[model samples]
Target: MKYISTRGSAAALDFEGVTLAGLASDGGLYIPESWPRFSDNEIAEMAGLPYAELAVRIMAPFTAGSLTEEELRGLCHAAYGSFAHDAVTPLVQFDQQHWLLELFHGPTLAFKDVALQLLGRLFENFLSRSDDHLTIVGATSGDTGSAAIDAVAGRERIDIFMLHPEGRVSEVQRRQMTTVLAPNVHNIAIDGSFDDAQAMVKRMFTDPSMATSHGGRFRITAVNSINWARLMAQVVYYFAAALQLGAPQRKIAFSVPTGNFGDVFAGYVAAQMGLPIERLIVATNVNDILHRALSSGDYSAGTVTPTAAPSMDIQVSSNFERLLFDAGGRDGAALAEQMRGFEASKAMQLTNAQREGASALFTSARVTPEEMVKAMRWASDHCGEIIDPHTAIGLYAACSMEIDAAMPIVTLATAHPAKFPDAVSEATGQHPELPARLGNLFEREERFDSLPGTYEAVRDYVAQRATESA
Candidate 1:
């Protein structure tokens, strides 16, 4: 259960180490050296298991000696018991063959809560014992900020700073982050796009001087899928979804809306673990670099166009490094060269081996803004089901692909439609009502730190917060 950096330079780490170190020091994501497999019996037993207990079963292998099965189960149950749904991630049959895995019934009303909630508790457990305080900085286009804030806010051992594109998120999305009054949480409205905010967060983490100057008193981490725990928790729903729909008997496929590639990458990890999945479809909006990469082997960033699905507007997909690590094509230097080339030139090419790796297990497709809205209408009109813009991209991408009657498909409904009220209302002719918990979001005053979008600027801001007394 050792984790190794994709770039092949950083020291191999264990589960907790990988969880705390979101991105590798070599600017790569950490991936498990070997995937853990579950017996058919274990998969069968997943039925009727509590969400937290299921998570422990699915994640125990990845954690190795970090926590025993019983300890992990306790942590997971404590974490998810507060969620809004009884089933945690419930399955709803949209049609006879197609189904929606409802993942938005948590505190923040996004699939992120499935993992971020547990991540917060894990951090509290690990950090409190060591008396080590953490400064968590994350960049989100939509749901990540709210989920991160909701989980980390008011915690004694951590201070969180989240950045989102100033004008890009929906009004509800922005308000969700802005209205939190937790003294330990801060939200930033970056002047540019989601990519800009993501880039800044990475720059801060990569700054060697920031770590040296922090005097070892302050630790920096992330809540994004860059965190291994986030990805680990996400992987459970994939297995649970497949099992509920008949996994070993019926091959399952997932259609995940692409952004930073974390969610889809989770399914990829599951496939590598020899889960009986048919296909892992990578769906996207106009920010379709991953889609293009899969279709034609071209990894190039087009302009980050602002769309109703702003969460998918990322040009730099972070979790792709893990895929490349397992893709089995090139050495570390060659992979590093490709990564640097993309960062510098905004484009990179996948070699034959790399392309084959992607082709082996994943398919890619893109949807336009117009198509997303249309599909939302079509799904609701034809099936009486409303989809959020992000989920709409996933639904259309899943539908547009050649229908394979051999396997049932599960589309990752990434966010609650209420998060994008305007887009959903326009497409479905009805606005989604927010959960009762979020009813007073507009009334709370938020606290946050703002800085220029640069490595030094953010590094200094993180340092200052880490020095603050709770």
Candidate 2:
């Protein structure tokens, strides 16, 4: 399967090329030239398969020409073998209508583990074929940094430099990234918001100076959702949840707590692949650029507001461009022009086509701190489940929507409650303890550096330390 950039200018790439090249050279995201659809029988055949087996079936189409089915299955099993649960991503019923898909079962205890674990292995497999070194530059709000770090730490032929906004993430979130002292892992605390760090990451991809620093053989890639492989792995869980809830004959709705838009866009990709999805609810916190854009066609970035849900404190939703490109008739040139304008002004209006296309299977809601806390309390009091703030926001939105009463809504439990103990404690009057598996996270020694949030600062830091390709 060939992947094409959202902007028309970049050469089309196969899955391996796209996996190694996170962002398109023309400042666009890569999407499959065409979505591979499954017949009803094909999707029905997927039911009851183990998570690893099911992953191979769903991802086989996308990984064509890069990995054999056996090779993909081996990677899937190896990646998921460390998950604490056999189900990998388990489902918990909250009530008659609402259920939670628990996705924090892996080593890092977040939904990102579902993909980054496999991504790290993919990097190892591909890089082993050649001596070319990969410098993975990524930006994270809370979860991505830790999950990505955990995945790639100590691996050969790879060095990861992850940047997070200093003092903006939860204590657990920060330590999860910083405590891992693997020589290949470099965590930088930037004095800015997630958007600033994300902007620098994106800029590094296009900056010629960055390429010059690494010399002839070094290539800079991404571990962020901008990577198609990461996003592609996320699509499997949607199928897992939907099939378990009776798909093919019955449609399922998912409520995703997303800040980067990658998680929910995976749902969009599942829907494109002919999964029987009734609706996808895009859940957001106080930084409601996604909510505003979906509801009123106003795609604009506002000032970052630090909240209990620090992960969602983002104004620029990077993956939103993928949706716009797909929904806006795949007119890359037009979308590129639109994006250029938005970049210059920090805002843009969604066209009629984009709005209409998105509204077909997508709905959105913005949750407030009060409502999020209320949901947390409701779950604890009524359902006997204590949830993290981000999951509570998704549950709040799921309850607020008026979907068919007979149909079930699954909220994506994005992180472990212990990761944000203070927020969970404040909301439900219950302090969550870290799982034994993550032993003494706070007590572990951490290594990282603080830098001003400038592209130049980040570029120089990475260039100085990143290994030159062999």
Candidate 3:
């Protein structure tokens, strides 16, 4: 599949090029030129497939000639074999109508692991033999940092530097990323929020003179959802959950606790690929820009306030670029205007077509912190489920939405509850237990470089690190 920039200006590229170049030169996410579709019968035939097998089957079309099916399956099998659960993403029947998709069973204990683990393997497979190296820069509110570090740590050809707002993430979340002692791994403690970190990463790409590789053969890529491979890997569980619930025979709905809109947009990609999914529920915390945009058809940004759900405390949802592309009336110039407006005035004018594209397959709700606490307690009482703050918001919204039981409304349980022990403990009166593998996390010494929210500071830091590594 050929990938095109969502801004509609950059030249189109295939799977490998897009995978290697996380964000396009024009500062837009890459999307397939044409979606690869699967028939209802074929989707039906995927029933009873193992998670890894199902992933290879669902993703093969997108990665078609870049990596053969057998190679992809090998990578999938290896990536998932180390997961804590046999079913990489196990579906729990929260209720007859409601199900919680357990996505935290992988190495880093978050939904990102479901994709980044595979992405790490894919990058190794593709880049190892070429004598070229990569420096990965990612911004995380909580989970993505640790997941990326886990996937990229100890790799000789890749150096990953993960940035997070110093005091924003939970202790476990911070520990998860900062405790990694690999030579190729680095954790950046930025004195700002996730938006600041993300902006820095984007600026690193936008700076025309920024060079990651001294030899010029090495390049930069992201393990963030901006990366096509990350999104492609995330699309698997949508199909897996749909197939598990009888997709062609019945439809499904997803209540995704989204941060950057990448996870929920994966559901949209599934819908585009002919998965029989009804409305995709856009679940969010109090910092709910997308929800308000969907309800009013006016896209705008506000000061991102910190909530119990720090991960979703983002104002500029990056993946919305793809939705704007899907909306189609807006071209590069229009999108350029929209983004420039958002950056300056903290809001933008979105056309009815842009809103329609979002509203067609998506409906939204903003769950309060109080509601999240109650939902966590309620789920613990009712279904013996203890979800993280973000996931609890989704469950709360799912319980309230006019959901169809027959359609199997699957909620994406984005992170492990242990990531937010204080919230989980206060809500359920029991500390969410950590996995044994991460048991030593609290005692590990954190190593990170703290920096102010300045593009020059970030550029200098990364440049110095590149020089030392060389």
- Give the winner by TM-score: 2
| Each candidate structure's count of clashing pairs | 1, 0, 0
Model 1 poorest 10 in a row by lDDT: 446-455
Q: Write the per-residue lDDT of candidate 1 for residues 5-111, one digit (tens) a residue.
A: 77888889988888777888888778887788876776777777777787888888998778778778888898889878888888877676677888898888889
lDDT (Cα atoms) of all candidates against the true structure = 0.83, 0.94, 0.86
Between which residue pairs do clashes occur in model 3?
Answer: none
lDDT of 1 at 17: 87
192-289 in candidate 2: lDDT tens per residue?
99999999999999998877755656788999999999999999999999999899888999999888999999999999999999899999998999
Model 3: per-residue Cα lDDT over 1-470, one tens digit each: 78888777888887888888899988888888788899888888899999999998889989986888999999999999989999899999988899999999988889999899889988888896587778888999899999999998998788898889989988888888988999999888988889889988987887766763455756778888989899989999998888888888888888999879999989999998999888899988888888887888656777788888889999878887777777656476678667777777877766788877777788999999899888999899998888899999998888889865566888999999988999899889989889888777888888999998887888788867865674
TM-score of 2: 0.99
TM-score of each model, in listed order: 0.96, 0.99, 0.97
Candidate 3 residues lying further than 4 Å off, grouped into runs, are 212-217
Model 3 TM-score (2 dp): 0.97
Model 3, residue 278: what's the lDDT? 86
